[model samples]
Target: MARELEEVKWEKFKLGDLFRIKSNLQLNKNSFVFSENGEYPYFTRTVFNNGILGNVHYLDEEHKLKGNCLAVGMIAMRFFYMDKDFYAGQFTKRAIPIGFSLNSRLANYFITVLNKKSKIFQSSLVRNFEKVFKNEEVKLPVKNDGSIDFEFMTSFISELEARQISELEAYLVTTGLSDYVLTSEEEKFLEIFRENEVKWKKFKIGDLFEVNSYKKRFDANKVNILEEGHPYVVRTALNNGIRGYLKEDEEFLNEGNTISFGQDTATMFYQEKSYFTGDKIKIIKSKYKEFNKLNSHFFVSAMSKSFSTFAWGSSSFSISIIENQEIYLPIKNNEINFEFMETLISAIQKEIIKDVVLYTDKKIKATKKVVSNK
Candidate 1:
């Protein structure tokens, strides 16, 4: 933030002017379509778990319960971002963005800002939300031209995420933490990217990987009966979908060094250890060769860009669909440039590790000084 938040210009905008209020699906936990292995999120007024009650499948094809909207809980005054198609329970409503797309980052920022206005709400549930929100004004940053500064909102959120890893300038070498800084190789890579001169080639996922599906899903609720052993992966989009560590079943334990993808939930994580899953987890293995952890990071980025569109409708992101999906990767001499990915990720990790090393060193020094005083 170059300027302080308080220093930024703010403008008030009515909610009705920004979004159209739509009724929720009006489904409950016991709806006939609800399933533990369902495709879309079922939102409710609960103040926990992002207001999601559960997931459901086999929804009405003609129903207009779409994602990319803000789902609001009137009674609980809860707000949640629906990035993918979801079903809304009773007493909830959707805030469909009128003119622009609400990317996840922007939506999250809005949620935080919107919750600040919770004090104005009354005891009555906002059943007539359209009329209520029509007069509701939310303050937002505005440009000199009086337009909402969407770019600032996105970049601020992005910078916050990057700040978690710290600023970069050094690289840790063997034996000790050495400040290598930016090497010529990295400078070249960065320059090419800055100039938009990097070439890319499209590769079909099925051509590069073998997609295996584990159908026999162990229930997370019932897993307590088995002796505790391995990780129990599930379909949630959070925490890499690892519900908990459960006892491994030889028949269900998937091998390590594989990409575990939630068949319907669209959650993905590289399984560094052999783990069991709850159900419908698609295990992806590279057909050419095993991708290392660094390379898997590149793959995950590519997969997200290509597969995010799969959730725009009622289509299931099944194994077959994943197989046929094509992702773009950096190209060198018309071939997939694995070296570039490896080098880029390696450089980034070294920089991050340097920050950790410096932080730990400072902490150790402070502790030593305290001990000496004692």
Candidate 2:
């Protein structure tokens, strides 16, 4: 993909030069009757869901933006490439390809460029996002004669899609390892050595780990700044609980790899760097001896699954409730089978690595072929 972009000549052009833009028609929110069984998607000025507020029964087929059109949110200033014919309601803008033809793949790629540009125009000074995007200039790949390279764009996107699919497949395989799924041959191999009764040991979380609560306060505004810095984040559902990064300063608190959790959100995260945390974030570390044997990544994965058992229907998790939580472990002889835990995680990592390597090789070859053809 990088080679293709490098080979092609690029030309800078204003967004209005490539697209015939249209601001959304004045349609009241009351007219959109959101329903579960609706046919058309009602689009609004929101960042998520391709700006889709909800599915509505309203039918304005002639006025609705066609599939493969780019929709820019006026309020959030984010770009979304519509995949289906949808209703474009109030406070939105649609950009239809003009002169040059664009497939779904190329339009999707353009969305990235537009979104990056939108990020730069932040501040109340640039209140009208639609107006700002209209005049923004973008550099696009062009052929030798300086025409848009649609073929290269399509192939480049396909290459990226293939790689992403492979990574997701690898993730799925690794995550599935926690639940033992034995093949027929493996099942038979273990049958001969399988013991009828296995020893189990139970211990409260506090017994094996140090639950330290830091009293250092982080200013919510400074810590939550969405910029590249040392990770000073609170926990959330996305990106393994990374809300955002923050800068390192005297006020910076917490360090080392440990299991972190959002007490309010009841989500688990593995923090590997020195960072600060929000009010409800709790950090748990294994005892000096236990840390050597226990794998933090494996512990995090297990704890995430166990969250439901403890949290139940509650949205928040109390520190008292978590410290007293007891966990079961397999015992060999009289001691905890730390080797078993290590081996299990190692096996999963090996399998996932194999899948990732194989897929990466295939993606490289495919990308080379596309570049060579050009």
Candidate 3:
């Protein structure tokens, strides 16, 4: 049985009273030796990836931060639960419950409530993090006797996890992605890939696609925003660069299955669905008809490689400049090898899916135990 949120008793408590918030050891990015199999996570101020920039080699005793605590990036107004010891980065803080233990579910509940105040904590007020945030109060569910209701919080999260686990199980079975075994053809293709046998040649961006200059100017504030609307594109490398949803305007809508390139940031993402955006963007549609979803992934990787040596992040690129840029592609007789692109992408997807299946299996087992105990 679950208690509805509306039916639960609530009480307000100052954030400072509930937890001890302290600044994390600020470390330089250059000092980090990052590795794929690193022992600690390097937490950054980014709202993405739960504030983790990447895993890094172990630091000294003073640098190591234990888990089972809330990691806060005050500047970004993001809160994340760290389940293991890791390294902290710039503008980071650690919040530990006062005279209380925080498990994953409990930490999630607290973070969910805390993040509701995130909208007001902008860059201008970042310097007043402790003064402004520590004094702020948050509402939490309580029992009739006035104690905080940890049981209700745990139950709510457990039920949510159970539903997600069931959906994942169905998805794995229906898609047949649960079986991670590699096929004979895939193995052969990988061997050739390992040998670096793929043909490579450069092709100008302008020659492969038509760079469209949107005829009309777009005003974001004037646009009708909707809950269930079309994607409003932005200049970012995260979340496919989609910032929000807006009422679909046929006049402003850019075609689907195209790449949206940010001129100033040089960030690019393949737009799977039709989207609309403002300036500093160049929507490019492929000249060839075979540039579908799978092939688009391969092309995006190649497009990123094109900008790597061009000092992409720090530099700006105009439509004229990007058009002249060339990317190396797998070619057959000096033509783009669409067949090879599709095959390589398919194998890559399966390889990634194997890891996801393993994670889903673990979640399902854990969720079942939570449900059974209830």
Candidate 4:
């Protein structure tokens, strides 16, 4: 009741024989800017994930008119034969296939097969590739009808795409539900909002915290994360609004007693945590009696929302910018308890973490079912 695995004869061929391989046009020192009304889509290493496109960057007319490039559905294999050549920085390799003459549907299927088989080839010339591409051999299956079964291959790929879309929709729905839950809790807490404006006083964050100005040391060969070393933070991570404890066992700074924030993308993402391996993070340590309650995780999350305004308020990176950034704090005798709010937030975080684990399991099961059927 299931289709048997076809035992078609396979032919081996060189990659250079099938298509022309070339590096993308270097954009010099100019930064890429995305335009909504731009003429053409810009492709990059980030475009490919599990053999699919993510986001397309748009370029103005000048760049678009230079050369006609491959469109969606073509395979792009990163070139490794030359010593001076390097794949796109974001993702090292890609495979772009010829689209017109070849069956696009079968070509898609063939690309998937190539990806699976790429791990088997090896070369001494290349340093990073698990399988060497230049001297490697691949097998091509020919159908009995002479022409490849483009229709069947297309149907299979279409089915895969449909299933993937369904899974993505489900994931979105789950994310929405989690957001709703957190928002509802925040709303409930806000309901008890007391004006008690007299009890609230403004103070500079730097006045309450000790700032440590230090740089990270880097080593190219050392990649392992240190267990009890300083954590490195960067601006890019701050812009993305990601917050968490670092797991890497490497230290760039000698001391391990502060939290870092990104200053450049502060306006876009306020107090987001950024990752760094070297001298990019600004560490701040709390110096008050409430240090236990106002730890790095709690303080970082609070700042992630307004990092831009804080960064702009300062002129130099050396001085403790926290002193200039104002925040409202509850008085010791205030009727509304600050400890209660912290406890509620902690409980909500626990629930969200649990939900994430459950959702991940469901997605894994759904993917396994689809792959098994295929």
Q: Pick by lDDT: which candidate is best?
A: 3
Clashes of each: 1, 0, 0, 24
Candidate 3: list runs displaced more than 4 Å: 13-103, 111-138, 164-180, 311-321
RMSD of each: 18.1, 8.5, 5.7, 12.1
Q: What is the TM-score of each candidate against the true structure?
A: 0.50, 0.56, 0.70, 0.40
lDDT of 2 by residue, 1-374 (tens): 65555477889988777887777664566765789888767777777766788886756756665767888766566778877777876767778888876676787889888878765655434355546655879998887888877777787787787677556656656755333444454344244325534466876777767677644646676544656876665666777666667665645567557767778666777776767777677888776455542356666665665666664446566667777777766568867766555555555555456665566567667655755665
Per-residue error at 16 for model 4, in Å?
A: 15
What lDDT does the true structure give each of the candidates? 0.75, 0.67, 0.83, 0.44
Q: Candidate 3: what lDDT?
A: 0.83
C-alpha positional error of residue 67 in candidate 3 after TM-score superposition, expressed in Å: 8.2
For model 4 the TM-score comes to: 0.40
Rank order by lDDT, top first? 3, 1, 2, 4
Query: C-alpha displacement of 53 in model 1, angstroms?
Result: 31
For 242-311, candidate 4 gives per-residue lDDT tens digits of 3222445334333433455434443212222224433334556566544443233445555654354444
Candidate 2 residue 338 Cα shift, in angstroms, is 15
How well does candidate 2 match the true structure, expressed as C-alpha RMSD?
8.5
Q: Please report how far candidate 4 places residue 373 from its true position, in Å.
A: 7.7
Clashing pairs in 1: 229-247
Candidate 3 RMSD to the correct structure: 5.7
lDDT of 3 by residue, 1-374 (tens): 49987799999988888888878888888986789898788887888888898998877889788788988886768789988898888788888889789988898888898888787656446678777777889988899999889889888887887897898899889977787777777777767778999889989998998888654445667777555687778787787988778776577788889998887777789998988886677898999999998899988898888787765556668777888989889988888989888877777778989889889888998889879878
